[model samples]
Target: MITYQLSKPVEHGGHTYQNLSFRAPETGDLIAAEQFKGQISQTVAMLAMMSDVPLPAFKRVPLRELYQIMELTKDFLGNALATTGD
Candidate 1:
């Protein structure tokens, strides 16, 4: 799991979260996130699924932090693709 410390914490459902830990996304996560139409939305959905976090909670994340989170997700996908070709 990759744990990311949020620069700005997120509050949701009466609780605050300081960090998000993402497990490597499985094929099910990719299928699930496909309900979202755009690439960005899909990526965010995948992140939520991998982190076991509710999607609504992502609304409170700071913009800068969101970009970093996207980058992390991209890195995971990139690494997975790189290995699968071999």
Candidate 2:
């Protein structure tokens, strides 16, 4: 299990929303948490594909870059959710 924290409020179309946050059992830096990060990264990518948001340009970027983009996406989605009152 991986833990994620929302850095911004999620809001969409004048509504608020919330996103998932959990603590993982493994202990390591984000870079070292490959499995956990991979799961989150995949989830983010899927969501981006299904949403209005444009996907990232590079598909083979490093995990660190993916992690950063995922965090931003998570925050954006969280804010959208918050705004939608989800």
All candidates: TM-score: 0.82, 0.28
lDDT of each residue in 1-86, candidate 1, tens digit only: 88899987888998788999999899898778777777667777878888888899976678788888878777676643332211
* Regions more than 4 Å wrong, model 2: 1-38, 47-58, 79-86
lDDT of all predictions: 0.78, 0.39
The parts of candidate 1 lying over 4 Å away from their true place are: 79-86
For model 1, the run of ten residues with the poorest summed lDDT: 77-86
Give the Å error, residue 50, model 1: 0.8
